[model samples]
Target: MRVMAFDYGTKRIGVAVTDPLQIIATGLDTVHPNQIIDFLKRYMQTEQIERFVVGEPKQMDNTPSQSAIHVKGFVNLLKKTFPDVPIEMLDERFTSKMASATIAQSGMGKKARQSKALVDNISAVILLQGWMSKP
Candidate 1:
C-alpha cells in the first residue's frame, strides 16, 4: 500500500508519496494551505494512497508548539475529509534544517535554497523517509 506524507505549515503544505511497496518516499510538491484538501482529494483519486502521515511539529524539548496546533487542525481536516484512510503523526523536529543541508550539499544555488516551497517539500520527503524506516 502507498502512503502519503504531509509537512503542514502555516503558509504551505509539503507533500510526499511512498512507492507502491511503501519502501521509498519521494518529494511531490508544496501547495497553498487552502488548497491542501482539494489537492489531496485529487491525488487520492489518481493514486492508490492508503494512509496519510502528517508531521507533528514540536519544540526541541518535545513540548507542543504553536505549529503543532496548526498541524493538529490540518490533521483533523484530513480525518473529516477522508475518514477511511488512517492518519498518523510523526515527530518533525530537525527535518527542515536537514532538508536545507541536503539541498546545500546538492550544489543548488542560493536562489533555489531561498524557495520555501522547495525546502518544505524536501522536508516532507525526509519526514516520510524517517517514518518508513521505523520498525
Candidate 2:
C-alpha cells in the first residue's frame, strides 16, 4: 500500500507519493484545487493509496492559520469521498520557508527555483517526511 501527502494551497496543491514499502516519499506533481479530485481519481487507477497525509497550516502559538479553514473543508471532502482511506493532518509550520531554503542549496538556477510548482512539490515532500518520522 502507498501513502499520499498533500501540501494544500489556495491556487495549487502539491502532491507526493510514497513507495509501496512506505520508505521514500517522492514529489509527484502540483494540481489545481478545482481539479484535485479528478487528478486523484486518475492517479488512483494506477496506484493503491492507503492513507493521506495533509499539511495543516498553523501559527507559532499553536493556533490555526488563515488558510486552515479552507484546508479543513478540503479534508472534509476528502473524507467523504475516500471513506476507506484514512486521512491524517500534520503540522506544516515553516515548511514553505524550509522548501525554499532547500531549493536554494540544491544548485538549481534562480529561474527554476522560483517556480511555485516546484516549491509546492518540495513542501509536500517535506510534510510527508515529517509525518513518516513521527513515532
Candidate 3:
C-alpha cells in the first residue's frame, strides 16, 4: 500500500509519497496551507494512499509548542475527512535543516536553497523515508 507523508507548516504544507511497495519516498510538492484539504482530496482520488504520516513539530526541549496546536487541528481535519485511513505522527526536530544539508551536498546553488518550497518538499521526502526505514 502507498503511504503519504506531510511536513506541515503555517504558510506551506510539504507533501511526499511512498512507492507501492513502501520502499522509497519521493518529494511531491508544497501546497498552500489553505489548499491542503482540497489538494489531498484530489490526490487521494488519483492515488491509492493507505495511510498518512505527519511531522509533529516540537520544541528543542522536546516539549509541545504552539505550532503543535495547529498541527493537531490539521490532524483532526484529516481524521474527519478520511476516517478510514490511519494517521501517524513522527517527530520532526531537524528535518528542514537536514533537507538543506542534503541539497547543499547535492551541489545545488545558493539560489535553490532560497526556495523554501523546494526545501520543504524535500524535507517531507526525508521525513517519510525516515519513517519507512523503521521496523
Candidate 4:
C-alpha cells in the first residue's frame, strides 16, 4: 500500500509519497495551506494512497508545540474530507533541523538550503523515511 506523508505549516505544506512497494520515500511537492485539500483531491485521482502520515511537531520536552494546534485542526478537516484514508501522527521534533542539515551536507548551496519550501519537502521525506523504518 502506498502511503503519503505531509509536513504541515500555516503557510506551506510539504508532501512526500512512498513507492508502490512502500520501500522508498520521495519528495513530491509543496503547496500553500489553502491549496492542500484541492491538491490532495487531485492527487487522489491519480494515485491510490492508502494512508497519510502527518508530522506531529513537539517541543523538546515532548509537549505539543504551538504550531501543533493548527496541525490538529487540519487533521480534523482531513478526517472529515477523506474519511477513507487513515491518518497517523508521527513525532517531528527535529525533522526540520535534520532536513536542513541534510540539505546543507548535500552541497545544495546556501540559497537553496535556506528555502523554506525545500526544507518542508525534505522534512516530509524524513518523516516518511522514519515511518517506513519502524518495525
Candidate 5:
C-alpha cells in the first residue's frame, strides 16, 4: 500500500502519492474540490492507498489559520466518503511559498512560474515528502 497526500484548497486540491514501497512521493493531479472523492475512487481502483495526509493550514504563531476551517470541512467529508482509510494532518504554513520558490529557482519560464496549478501540485509533493520524512 502507498501513502497519499493532499494540499487542500477551496478551489483546487493538489494530490500526491508514494510508491508502493513507501519510497518517494510524486505529484499526482489537481482536482476540483467537489470531485476529490470520485477522483480517489478512481485512483483506488488501480492503487492501494494506505492512508491520506492532508496539509493543515496554520498561522505563524502555530494556531489554525482561516483556511483550517475549510480544510476541516474537507477532512470531515473525506472521512465520511472513505471510512476505511485513515487520515493524517501535517503543518502546511510555507508550502506554497516553498513551491513558488522552487519553481522560480527551477528556471521554468515566466508563465510557468505563475501557474497556480503547478504551484499546488508541487505543494502537494512537498506536503507528502514532509510527512514521509517526519520523525
Candidate 6:
C-alpha cells in the first residue's frame, strides 16, 4: 500500500504519492476540490492507498487558523467518502515558502517558478516528505 498526501485549497487540491516502500514522494497532480473523490477512485483502481496526509493550516501560536474550518469540512467529507482509509492531519506552515525555495534551487525559470499549480504540487510533495520524516 502506498501513502498519499494532499495540499488542500479552496479551488484546487495538490496531490502527491509515495511509492509502496514509502521512500520517495512525487507530485501527482492538482485537482478541483469537487473532483477529488472521482480522481481518487480512479487512482485506487490501480493503486492501493493506505492513508492520506492532509495539511492543516495553523496560526503562529499553534492555534487553528480560520482556514482550518474549511479543512475540517473537507476532512469530514473525505472520511465519509473513504471510510476504510485513515487520515492524518499535519500542521502546514511555511510549506509554500519551502516549496518556493526548492523550486528556486531547482533552477527553474521565473515563469515556471511563478506557476501556482507547480507550487501547489511541490507543496504537496513537501507535505508528504514532512510526514515521512516524523519519528
User: Which candidate ranks first by TM-score, i.e. highest?
Assistant: 2
Poorest stretch of ten by lDDT in candidate 4: 105-114
How does candidate 3 fare on TM-score?
0.96
Report the Cα lDDT for candidate 2: 0.95
Cand. 1 TM to true fold: 0.97
User: Tens digit of lDDT per residue, candidate 5, span 1-135?
Assistant: 999999999999999999999889999999999899999999899999999999999999999999899999999998998899999999998999999999999999999999999999999999999999999
Prediction-by-prediction clash tally = 0, 0, 0, 0, 0, 0
Q: After superposition, how far is residue 68 of candidate 2 from its true place, in Å?
A: 0.4
lDDT by residue for model 6 (28-109), tens: 9999899999999999999999999999999999999888988899899989999999999999999989999999999999
Clash pairs, model 6 backbone: none
Relative to the true structure, candidate 5 reaches a TM of 0.97
* Per-residue C-alpha lDDT of model 4 across residues 1-135, encoded as one tens digit per residue: 789999999999999999999999999999999999999999899889999999998988999999999999889989999999999999988899999999999998889989999999999999999999999
Candidate 1: C-alpha RMSD after superposition? 0.8
Task: Give candidate 2's error at residue 22 in angstroms.
Answer: 0.6
lDDT of 1 by residue, 1-135 (tens): 799999889999889999999888999999999998888888877788889999988898899988888888888998898999999899999999999999999999999988899999999999999999999
Backbone clashes in candidate 5 total 0
Relative to the true structure, candidate 6 has a C-alpha RMSD (angstroms) of 0.8
Candidate 2 lDDT, tens digit per residue, 1-135?
Answer: 999999999999999999999999999999999999999999999999999999999999999999999999999989988899999999999889999999999999999799999999999999999988999
Off by over 4 Å in 4: none
Model 2 regions lying over 4 Å from their true place: none
Residue 88, candidate 2: Cα error in Å is: 0.4
- Residue range with the least summed lDDT across 10 consecutive positions in model 3: 40-49
State the TM-score for model 2. 0.98
Estimate, for each residue in 28-48, the C-alpha lDDT of model 3 and write its tens digit. Answer: 899998999899899888789
lDDT of 5 at 65: 94
Q: Least lDDT summed over 10 consecutive residues: which range in candidate 6? A: 65-74
